[model samples]
Target chain A: MNVNQVVQSIREKVAEGISEVYFVACGGSLVDMYPSKYFLDSEAKKLVAGLYTANEFVHALPKRLGAQSVVIVCSHGGNTPESVAAAQTAKEHGAHTIGLTHNKEAALLNYSDYSFLYEWGDDSNVKNNPMAIILDLAVQLLHVVEGYAHVEAFQKGLESINGIINQGKKQVAPRARVFADKYRNEELYYILTSGASYGHAYGFAICSLMEMQWLNAAAIHSGEYFHGPFEVTDKETPFILMMNEGRTRALDERAQTFLNQYAEKVEVIDAKELGIGTIADEVVEFFNPVLFYSIICVYREALAEVRNHPLETRRYMGKVAY
Target chain B: MNVNQVVQSIREKVAEGISEVYFVACGGSLVDMYPSKYFLDSEAKKLVAGLYTANEFVHALPKRLGAQSVVIVCSHGGNTPESVAAAQTAKEHGAHTIGLTHNKEAALLNYSDYSFLYEWGDDSNVKNNPMAIILDLAVQLLHVVEGYAHVEAFQKGLESINGIINQGKKQVAPRARVFADKYRNEELYYILTSGASYGHAYGFAICSLMEMQWLNAAAIHSGEYFHGPFEVTDKETPFILMMNEGRTRALDERAQTFLNQYAEKVEVIDAKELGIGTIADEVVEFFNPVLFYSIICVYREALAEVRNHPLETRRYMGKVAY
Candidate 1:
């Protein structure tokens, strides 16, 4: 079934009452689920939503998880042990479980009530990527259960996201190349963003920069920048700022203004310049994360080339028993 | 009234209903409130709790912050503009608002339905510190509204906490001095902890290390270590691991084992060795944060002395426009 039809089926089964939705996974998979949680938190007035690391979710299983809860678990290959255990725990607690992965024969699929396959490494099928599919599940559930008015706009967004991502990657390639050359020798980086766009900066910082390149990086939330993190900003500090074109845009702009004044090396990446304007205004923010993620992938590739370090190089992951 | 009586009064006033509680502040104040949120999430079966940065709380106010909500705002000197604005926003939404600060004349007190003062710079009155008082509010409310059985033990903990903290400082002083000497030249550090103890590591990393000393640091959650972050762990990496004696202790231990195997400069400060054992086992976890926070203050002070950098030194915090 399609993402919408699978969500519709779950909605029909839980028609009597549904109070909560949980998104749980690890690393990039956990980061991919944030936009869906952000969408639900922003749109649903009554439904509760939570995003957690898979092990934390399993260790502290919410008392509210029951027949009225929908737990969404994801792993790219559907082989993360903690994520599989979380799905099994959710099932044991009688919560409806939905699993997203590229592998159909994985243990996560066996434990979940509904399994949805998303495309992996397929540039032509961006809509079927894990991030897009999980977000669609949220969009569909909110539309069916809580009467979302932007369903049409959201659907249009899904249809045109691949073209928008391609445009974004092409537009940002020159800047990405410059970033790679300039910061090639730098040891640490700080990626800043906020709201629905936070996960993209986070996944790129951890998965691409830290894990792949063996460099130090941290994702600093733009809204929280003025609090304590801004003190670390100076003329030599390297910062990558992700700006959104939504309600939290003012927060991002405020941080941008500060960074421009105090820091010399600030890379400003904005969703408005990435063809999100082609999408309907009502649902543009929901598409911002995928655009940011796709363009940042180009940045990662550029860095990998300049540093002579492959994106898949690992020191501990899958190499040692960590 | 005392902290317990203030909470009791709020409980009586909101006898009709209270479904959610939000803890909002900035910097160290925000970090200080996480244990209370963690306590509510771990103990309460029906009460919903959220911890957010003050600006985010004001900008993206939760839809559930209405008549059936309790919003708690904290600022050390009570002059943080965002936190005061959050209290006003909560009041405008008809929620029961509680404000904690050291200043009774602050604007936060004016906007809040109830104001409680916590002692500052008074080691003799450690029980009345901001973290302890805010946590007491949660404990008292839970006992009154939801019938917590650990009330007596929790009260005993509050009474004896100051003594425990003094003893803890004495116990960890030598280790703190050694840490200062070893990392006096280091420019970046990562503080790691999990569960209720997470706030201590976070507050220390941001407020003390970054904001005060102008060093770069990030608080890494221990449960999330195995995902993407463990790749950066090496024999030369400086890590401060805070161990807990709570339900999430196993997660901390797992990370501790990995850090021991891979990292050489790990400083392990545990709750069990710091006199938390004197408190009742049922109520011990809630005190872990305050213990961690207090001892870490010693470490920060030691580092400040050895590095010749005052903890009050800042380039942009209060010197210029944000």
Candidate 2:
């Protein structure tokens, strides 16, 4: 089913008395939940939202998770143990569990009250990707339940996201190649961003750079950069700053101005220059992650090619068991 | 004022109508706010809580901030600009503002509806530290507003914390020295923990290690270890694992087991062994940050002694303008 159809079905089921929405997942999937959670937190009048790692959510279950709650759990492959367990726990509490995954037959589906299958390998259906779908759900839910006014603009923005992402990929290619070449031998890189773009930067740092490329990387919030992490800035240090056109853009720009002066290498990926400027300013921030995901994928691909390491290459992730 | 008295004042002022709580701060102070926010998130049935860096809090003000909201802003020295702005914004929104600081005369106080001064140089008053004070406020508010049952036990535990910390300091000295010696020359270190202890680990990595010592470090959540970070672990990797005896202890243990096998230098600081076990099991996790804070201060001091790099020696923090 399309994302709107999925949201329509969800709206028809638990739209009356829902008070809480939980975005629970793990790893990259957990990061993917951030934008939607951020959206709800910023816009929802009566709905309280939470974003949690599935394991922590299971261990420290919120006291309010009952029939009034709608818990959304996401796993890329639909088989993350913690995600499955979180769904089951939410189910036991009588909260409606919405499971999102790329796989058709997922364990999460069995425990979920509703399941949405997102496109995995299909580039043509960029809007059907897990992050995009979850975000669409959040937008639709907010609009349906609380009369969020920007729903139409959000959907229109999403419709143009594929084109925006394609343009972003092309626009970022030259810089991505340059960054890969320049930082090819560097042992550590810090990925910094704020607001909605933070999650994508986190995914890029951990999943793409550290896990896939075997490079030391950390994702730092731009707003939190001045607090303590800024002390690490020096002539030898390198940084990747993800800039988004959003309410927290000033935070990113502040960090950027500092990084340009202190850090020798600062690779910036600005959403405004990546076609996000064409989007309605009100709803553009919500799409920052989608655009960022595409741009960073280009970066990781370039880095992988330059480093002669495939993105799937792993040493201990699946080969050895703890 | 004494913590309970401060909480009493807070309870009397806005306790009747509070529906949302925002914990706003920066750097180590931001980490300090995590425990209370976590406590509220786990225990409070009606109050929605948010933990944010002060800048983000100011920039993306929650739409729910109003007369029914309580904003807790903390700045150790009481002059963090973003924190002051957050307090001001909260006041503008007609939210009840509670400012926590060590300084008696602070800008934050001007914007706050109520203010609590914590002890900075007074080691005898550990219970009046910012984290302890905010946590006490949370506990009392929970009890007064929602009738949280463990308030007395939490207070008793707070009274015993000073002695527990002193004992923990002596107990951890030998291991701290060993860890400092083993990783004295290391260029990069990763601090890992889960649940309530994660914030303390984050403080140790960014504030104590990176900001103070000018070392490269990243704090990884133990629950997130297997996700992408574990791939960076190998025989040469050095790690400082902060383990707390909490609901998420299993997550920390799982990461510790993997780190012990794959990483050469795994420095484990167990709260259970650090006198946290003496506290009531029901309230132990809430105090993990307090225990971990003292233990890591020992680790950082030992590191500074071994490296002959004074913790106050900063190249850019306050010496140069960003």
Candidate 3:
């Protein structure tokens, strides 16, 4: 997987003129693109970016996605029907489409104008992680349009991603073990976070917990928790809080304070406590989600082990005709 | 409330070359702004629109939110600390701030550049509904910016909202009662929808079920459900589907077909069956969410009654110090 070549090809499209960028994918892929979407929205100088589930993208066919649009489709298997269809739709709308997958022969590659095949892995290794690749692509696009300096810091942070993941695994093991044991019998759990880590909270809740383990879980943004979800808190209620080193840390701190007062079973996965600060000071906010994802992956595995549910176990996901 | 006057004041601000619009609120109020946010993004020709939870809005402080920004803040009680702080922050950033609330004497009014007070009630009557008011305001801004014809169709539909509400109530009651009876003892539920009605599913699950009724529920977008949440469905799992007459109807239909094959406890609230078509044909997509909200409100009431709970009963929301 030549990332530079992929970035160069996307840069050429940007040179031609792309007024907007759409990150289109399904499920885990959609979740993978979210951090990139947030990064592009905040960093891109001239391009407007939006995130959409592949099916909805095909249905709504956003008015802004036209000749000057750049659509990025992501699928680990590269054969997700909705994603392939979304790429086809983007082409029909005269948008430049790019597909990112681990399988070169996947169906999504057939429709994308440009396709990049990377490596997929088990729970341990972090190389060529889909989320990291998407984030890097987003930053590279901004680097092409905006400037190299603005993204230089992020690029530097990306260099240490493998180390960060290893560190996260080490730091999260004990906590994950404790949490898995403590809440083994709990039928439902709420995962809470804010800002850059919100996407991880959402993705982990739905993909890892609900889909993979068939556990009942909901992810609530810390900022929105006080609004209504706080009502669910009680002396025995269980919550997992992902505290990131970002602008919205105060929101998570606020939630932590409240949860501490009411809930006895509260698990906190603070990026700072996990030594995220040692990676890079300036770009820590952008990397917090990546760290959180790495940690939660370990947490998921631990929970799966304790609950006697394999992470790959699924009743209906790809086995059925849905 | 004089909606026309509110329109007039916002129109004058639009004439001053508004660059962006921020719909800032929290909880149910945040959910109320989603349809408006969608409308603004799709309809506002020259203006950019973004939705942010109140705390996140203040924390992120988007670079685009300056003198040319129009920030609309909503708080049912008009005293929500985060919302009030968001409005104050918007004002400090030189953006034109508007606050919508049920109490004129509330603290939000003090920081808002303009304020509108409307009647609030128990979940039955749709008259002056918070979501409706916000949608109307968003359409009014679009009307001011890009001629009147596109919005006139929506305005016409708005006039018949009360009738639509009445129709929805009658149509959903029997199904709501049946669903409430069948799922009364279920420990958790999954609510699914797409497009405009997505917000209703989200709001109903959080505000009505989690907050008011103290039930566990998660809202999943129909388009995204197949990606991950489909794994949770079985012969015994309970799900509430909001099928709307909109562009995303096919997505919901697809989910319905899948759920029907696997889940025995699927309760669907279809807007087409609710007579949303007879009232207005041209803008039924825009009215679909309002219709769904109304129907779900009745469903929530039915569920509350069957579960021996009251809608206004809160364990911590307004009673806690968080």
Residues A230-305, model 3: lDDT tens digits: 8878877778999978678899999999998899989999988877776555556778888887788888899999
TM-score, structure 1 vs. true: 0.95
Mind giving the per-residue lDDT tens digits that candidate 2 earns over A1-322? 6656765666676646568889999889998888999888888877889888899999989888988788999998899898999999999999888899888888999998888887765275578888888898888777767788888888899899999888778888898899899888888989999887788777887799889988888889999989898998988888988898989899999999998888888888899887788888888888888888878889889999999999999998769986
Predicted candidate 3 versus true structure: per-residue lDDT over B72-159, tens digit per residue: 9999889999899999999998888889999878999999887778666655345477788778777776666565456666777787
Alpha carbon lDDT of residue B189, candidate 3?
Answer: 84
* TM-scores for chain B, listed for all candidates: 0.97, 0.96, 0.94
Clashes of each: 0, 0, 0
Which pairs clash (backbone N, Cα, C closer than 3 Å) in model 3?
none
| TM-scores for all predictions | 0.95, 0.97, 0.94
When summed lDDT is taken over every stretch of 10 residues in candidate 1 chain A, the lowest stretch is A117-126
Question: Over the stretch B1-322, how does candidate 2's per-residue lDDT look in tens digits?
Answer: 6656755666667745567878999998999888898898888888788888999888888787888777889998888899999999999998888898888888989998778877775265678788888888787767766688888789899999888888998999998898899889998889998887778878887899889988888888888878888899888888988888878888889988898788888888888877788889888888888888977888899999999999888887778776
Using DockQ, give the best candidate's number.
2
Q: Each candidate: what lDDT?
A: 0.85, 0.85, 0.81
Q: Clashing residue pairs, candidate 1?
A: none
Model 1 is docked with a DockQ of 0.60
